[model samples]
Target: MLTKRIIPCLDIKDGRVVKGVKFLGLKDAGDPVEVARVYDKEEADELVFLDITASFENRKTLVELVEKIAKNIFMPFTVGGGVGDIGDIRNILNAGAEKVSVNTQAVKLPQLISEASKRFGSQCIVVAIDAKLVTSHQSPVTSNGQGTDKWEVYINGGRTPTGLDAVEWARKAAKLGAGEILLTSMDYDGTKDGFDIGLTKAITEAVGIPVIASGGAGKPEHFFDVFSKTSADAGLAASIFHYQEYSVRQVKECLREKGIPVRL
Candidate 1:
């Protein structure tokens, strides 16, 4: 039995953590370093830090913030945003990331995955995808969850929709040697409703690697529904954990109470 994981995500923009609805109306949460320290104390199973605007700004993830957050936390941490080549990967690792997450760059140049996997073990190469629903594109690349005819890939914090089928891209990333997939559902992002279970199930089933489900997670029970009802290996959330709506220990306890196997 796979022990389900509870992860807290820090969406960083301009070095500050922010939370918003469907990736809009961003509100300041706190310093990434401060929030990370709290999650570490709460015994979060894993931590994910995303420089939400790094790609948008067309630059590398803020190493200073990454260093600050990394030094404060002791658990496994994945840092992403605007990571392009081996040098960027090396710099992030040197700064303290346990894993380097690539999104826009990987999608643009698939070879980056193979190269990174070869340099750092596949386990350390996490491919993060930002996807949204579309309606007109037989395969419309979606940037955000505003609306659409097809599911598309968006880069730079859901600002540009890459006309590509998210499902197909998941498979391709895995084939290119991605070890884990961190998928965020733009449609469900910041909803506090629940995960897009259908999307979670799709990527988890399509890819052989472990899939980290992000975007929508409201209550502790929602976490249970995600792990048991879908193929996701881990449940990732931001506002819920960031605002202290629930603690990692509390979530794990709830999962145990619900008869879902967890590390506790």
Candidate 2:
């Protein structure tokens, strides 16, 4: 197995890091650059810096903020939120983000995925999907009618539903040349119980590229469960790390001791 990554997410709002429950009731955490520096010192595999309100606010990502945090951190930096076009992608990358994650825009204009992947290379494009569970009773008609659970894609920071199936969307994104999928479970976000293993497994199985399992990570064992139960290439959490419930180093040590391959 490849070394599993333990990623610490910094969800930024109004130029400050924030955390919330199920994408609501957001509370401040700290400055983005300072929080990023702490994650880098903790040896996090990558840093996901998201301007969570960017899309809803209809503005471009904070390029100056990205540059500030990017300059402070040594690990791979991914910036997302309000990334709508090729120029937005370029600006983020040029601002020092190694990867630009597109969510609302990707669903609205999938051609942008192809265009960006071709222009910047697939590795530079990370598609972020915010998913929430839709049960059989809610939808009631799967293609197979197996009463299987479904996850629908949401954008604009989980306020808008696009009626796209999460698994199918992942497959499409991969085909469109997305290098990776950052899958977040809206149902599980900030709950800190654990990752939605079923959701992670479904998307990972459907896509060929790496999938990062996100949301609801509470403890080191939560990371272990996601890695052991699914083919997720990485596990990302915000509140756990932001609140000091666990550190990236502690999570990696737990994963390694549990016989999962992880960088120390």
**CA lDDT, candidate 2, residue 193:** 81
TM-score (C-alpha, index-matched) for candidate 1: 0.85
TM-score of each: 0.85, 0.89
The C-alpha RMSD in Å for every predicted model, in order, reads: 5.4, 4.6
What would the TM-score be for candidate 2 when compared with the true structure? 0.89
Question: What does candidate 2's lDDT look like per residue over 227-259, in tens digits?
Answer: 888899999888777667677899888888999
Scored by lDDT, model 1 comes in at: 0.80
Give lDDT per model, in order.
Answer: 0.80, 0.83
Between which residue pairs do clashes occur in model 1? 134-148, 134-149, 134-150, 135-148, 135-149, 135-150, 136-149, 141-163, 142-152
lDDT of 2 at 186: 90
lDDT tens digits, residues 51-94, model 1? Answer: 76675353443777768777777788998877878888888888
Q: Where's the lowest-lDDT run of ten residues in candidate 1?
A: 139-148
